[model samples]
Target: MQHIIDMISNGTKMNESEHDELINEVSAELVELYEIEYDPDNLIPADDETANRILEAAFDLLEAVGVYSVDTKSVFTIPRDEIFRSVQNSQRYLNIGEGSDKYLLTLAGSSEKKKTSIMGGPNASPVTPEMFIPIHRSYAKYTDIDSIAPAYLDVPAGSAKKGPANLMKARQAVQLVKEACALEGRPDMCITTPPHIEDPVAAVSVANPRFMGSGDLQEIIPQQGLKVNYSELSRVYHYKMTGSNYLCSPMLVRGLSAATPEQFAIEIAAEALKSQVVYGASVFFKYPAHIHTGDPLKTLWASFAATQALSKNEICLQGSVVTSSAGPCTEMMFYETAVQTIGYVVCGCDILSGPVSNNGSITNQVSGLDAHFMAEVSRFASDLSLKDANYLCNELFSRYESKLNAPEIGKPFVDCYDMNTIEPTQEYWKLYETVIADIYYILQQKNRRISRR
Candidate 1:
């Protein structure tokens, strides 16, 4: 525990002043969160109490150093011994899915990647034993992702297929992991399976194992001494409700319905605490008129407030307008990325994921430039301290707040870039270069002022 503390607090040792400041800020924020108006009938007092306790522990650990990543919208801070002990004492493990030796190795390697901390694979697809080895090897070679999440296992809404066959898909996923282990020559991955236990057809049948059963996966995979990745638990939460729906409807709403941003955060933390898995919280920025009043600054502030209120865990607040609803243009894309990055930094998100455009649906060309631009800006902004980052984010938002409602989205991915070269078209690249230069200039000026101080 002391080792963990030292690892996290390497640069910024805690002083009395910093400790007091963190405690006061956290306490005040908790009070403010509790006072927010909500549908009273849906409130959960126990959840709120749990949230407060987590905050208290976080505050007491103020000596721990904290760092924010703009690319991921995630905040990484050291935990105090008491907090770690409390989490361990709570016995909060949620064994969701199956475990496999291969899957475990893939997960461990992915988790060690720099600047990337999450990996996800198709949950429904079944890979042949032949294909599984190559796929796992590809994953091992291509990306340095930290966690591998199960994707789309519960079959889409209109799929023609049915039933226990889904377990086959699960086995195939496990197979992919196993193949990867063979290629890597070392067993170092972590496997996590799904949580749903009750089979729909089984009114009372032991003959067929549940499709989403973690226990079944564990039983099948002969991997001993492997930890399961629990970060994917949120996927179950998403699957049971959202299924394959993409419009972000009541399904996503229900997941969030009962809790305030703060409360939801605590739930996320609790999940992380229980599983000891790397956890993430993300805020999807959709262009909702009522919430932001079409004011980008207000919208950014709202995002910041919500994300800040929920930064207890390894959370990432994704900031990007839904380009599908808004049309495409470079200026709107640039402004949105700038403001979003700023908000993410201020809110202390651990990882950040966009300058996303065309609603994250566009293909390479149109999307790549904005992604690259956003990534650069995010990287640049992350170099600043939280206070300065907040100031800049607020300033940018103030400048563009009036235009958020009708902000330009940008061209479709296929139409915007050259596929052969894997780069944006010349026109798009020129525009991106110009926008990036401008952002750098602004940041340079800010850096100068900070230096003078």
Candidate 2:
């Protein structure tokens, strides 16, 4: 810790620093992430040894770049040996939540565990306080969804009710979700996030200090990409102070920072490992691309390689079914979710389904049925092996990869789900049923292939 201070005192950046430094603020990540030291695109290695190489490479990148802290405008210049030791010392498994709702979280690819723990909710889509309760009910009612994440409050800066507090939304966020939990009779469902992790102190201020007693998950997101600000660090401190279960994943954009699919795997693998080492994350979430549903095959292969890198560590990783163009209700939305879900399941990783209805730029566009149908397909897909999974992924991607740009953003939640009853309407139910049945046929075909083999 002293060395970090000294390095910060001396300053890590040679140039005058910017306020928001994402992972590799310089835009050129020092590690190319090639295990074979060849082009990752054509010569990708599917073996455990390759994963090892990527892990080492990521560590080397961390060592060389030294993480930058935008809040302090300083670089964290720790020795590589010390960094590794810190990571090695972090706790591996975190048993979270109160009695009935407790979650046993492990590092990504931690073991040959069955049934990936479901953490379902809208992926922080914009939501009014009134709609929030019903939205959460949609997830809590599902048998498979074990945890719930709150939707982002449509609350804007200078909320009329809460005065000028930076965290007014945070407080409202906690209350809204808690209300929904009670309404659903699943008061114990572990909540990993409350809309945003941007303000850790404000985020934690709403908590009952006995977060340990309740066993809910609290997250800390390092600023930019892997860089830590005062806010992220404060959250980490609070997590330890409360003895709460911790989850962190410093995301990496595959297209922006990493030029190819293989680099995406290496960056995410390294980032996930960094979270474990740095944040003591029992499990971390890694996003494949900002392109969302744009490149299904590319994202799948990227997630596959990333999971392979973390598998050796027996770490648990949470992946998302992010969409580029597809939104709720449309067949495109269902198709994209299935392809992304298959990638994670076939790779043997858990899921954080649905932020499904938006391009990276669009907002306020997600719904319940996306997750409703996704969890069903994911459960069935989880039964397949990597070979069969990959074959299925290829077949599924062929359906929608071409239309990711101008996909039909389907109807809002109110239209498909009766806002009054919070149940799916007949039209939406049929849409979900059709997708599930289509996937079942695919699974049957997978079985036939296995028998033939």
Candidate 3:
């Protein structure tokens, strides 16, 4: 509490009343969420009535604490106690008496643009040579995003037709960073690379030359005007070999067929823990329900449970994206937004990077909206107590468990928001604003209760 206060006092500006209001609102919603979603034994009920109850509870909670700002992208830093209180008040709906539960608050960056600095091949969609400049421009424009995970840079030149070559791809990655920096006037943004690489030496060769690593964060210093940074790869080595403070994200889909999504997530998280790597997990959800028949909520729960088991030092949950084959739709986008935000709050993820749409296609304008929605939800979720957050998540899962596999992918970005304007359309923005306003009202209601007490 003192640390947060000191940080805020020392130039980290925050409006006390506004902050308190926000906290109170989220807390009250969480309390209601607890009643509907969480069982005292930490188990979720499987019945439809319980599920519907959980959904109603979550809807109220979402109405209260789920909306966030999409206009300005900034990190919110507030005291944990306030957040915990908000959740406690919300839990009153469940009749759970408020008890002392120390919560921790951390700053997180919220930028939804899918600008990969690393992977640039056929495997990664919409990453054409022509699209590079535009994407770079987008990155440059969104200076609010603290870091960027450059896409996988292993594809050799002229290999798109023949598939990726064995030739080291890191050097090319360096070139891409340099290019992206040159195009964007500001080169201060951090550049990160994928952890799963075939050649560590080549990967290092490219990163060591471009990036400066100090502790967990890496910075890309412009050498002829370009951002550069290297992140350790963790996919190939698995968690057992790496021991875990590195980024280790195995594709959820790939692991799902052979092992349960939860089991795969646990195995990967365990490896990250062993390496002490600040890991990132990407959970991809495809459309039509034919791909994976499992429950989305359960899959998310398994992933969160795995994340919870790991040491905070070893693993920092970078956000998870709900990817679908059907491209970015409104329902899918919202579903992803709701689930990922809830996961971040309940699971205590370090950074929330996406709601990546079209399985990696930049063509989906809705992807950007999804990103915006994610940022808003993330901000709301950040203001949650760990216990209440867990309960909230359990409730969300209970309500949306069946729909996970066959989630309704909403409208594409083109339909929802105008791409030409580089902002959400008025209609979309109105929807966004309404959601946020409702959430604000919920917070205000909670604040009034706090005053009475």
**Top lDDT model:** 2
Candidate 3: tens digits of C-alpha lDDT, residues 378-414? 6666665554455554544444345555555455444
User: In lDDT terms, how accurate is model 2?
Assistant: 0.62
Q: What is the C-alpha lDDT of each candidate?
A: 0.36, 0.62, 0.37
User: Positional deviation of 412 in candidate 2, in angstroms?
Assistant: 0.8
Q: TM-score of each candidate?
A: 0.44, 0.85, 0.50
Positional deviation of 237 in candidate 3, in angstroms?
A: 12
What clash count goes with each model? 35, 12, 40
In candidate 1, residue 287 scores what lDDT?
A: 26
Better of 1 and 3 by TM-score: 3
In the range 169-203, model 1's lDDT, one tens digit per residue, is 44545545644544554233333242122232221
**Candidate 2 ranges with C-alpha deviation above 4 Å:** 1-7, 16-46, 108-111, 156-164, 210-213, 293-296, 315-324, 351-355, 359-364, 446-453
Model 1, 426: alpha-carbon shift in Å? 1.6
Candidate 1: TM-score?
Answer: 0.44
Full candidate order by TM-score, most accurate first: 2, 3, 1
